[model samples]
Target: LVPPDILKKMYVLRRILNPMGTVDAIEFLLGKLRETKVNAEFFEKMNT
Candidate 1:
């Protein structure tokens, strides 16, 4: 297992190595833990 500090660094390094507009889930989780703000809107239209 990697220490959180070191693991975070690893994630950054991995992203630097391959930043092809793909998501890096680990970074997303880290951001969430840090209380990153996210906004979403949803609309549903149905006729019954």
Candidate 2:
């Protein structure tokens, strides 16, 4: 399990990086990592 302190830091970073939200920011990063072609199946699972 993730520690609360770490989660808080992630939240702060997420807010600063993208006002859209953490999930969106994660997806955006993943998309970038995959050259803007993130797998649809993986994305769907992440959203669930």
Best by lDDT: 2
Q: Write the per-residue lDDT of candidate 1 for residues 1-48, one digit (tens) a residue.
A: 865655566566556547534457566545544552432110011111
The C-alpha TM-scores of every prediction are: 0.38, 0.38
Any residue pairs clashing in model 1, and if so which? none
Q: RMSD to native for every prediction?
A: 13.8, 9.3
Model 1 weakest lDDT span, ten residues long: 39-48
In model 1, which runs have C-alpha deviations exceeding 4 angstroms? 20-48
**How many steric clashes does model 1 contain?**
0
Report the error of model 2 at residue 31, Å. 19
Task: Provide the overall lDDT of each model, using Cα atoms, as 2-decimal numbers.
Answer: 0.45, 0.56
- Quote model 1's TM-score: 0.38
The local lDDT score (0 to 100) that residue 1 gets in candidate 1 is 80
Cα lDDT of model 2 by residue, 1-48, tens digit:
765655565566556557767787777766645753554433334322
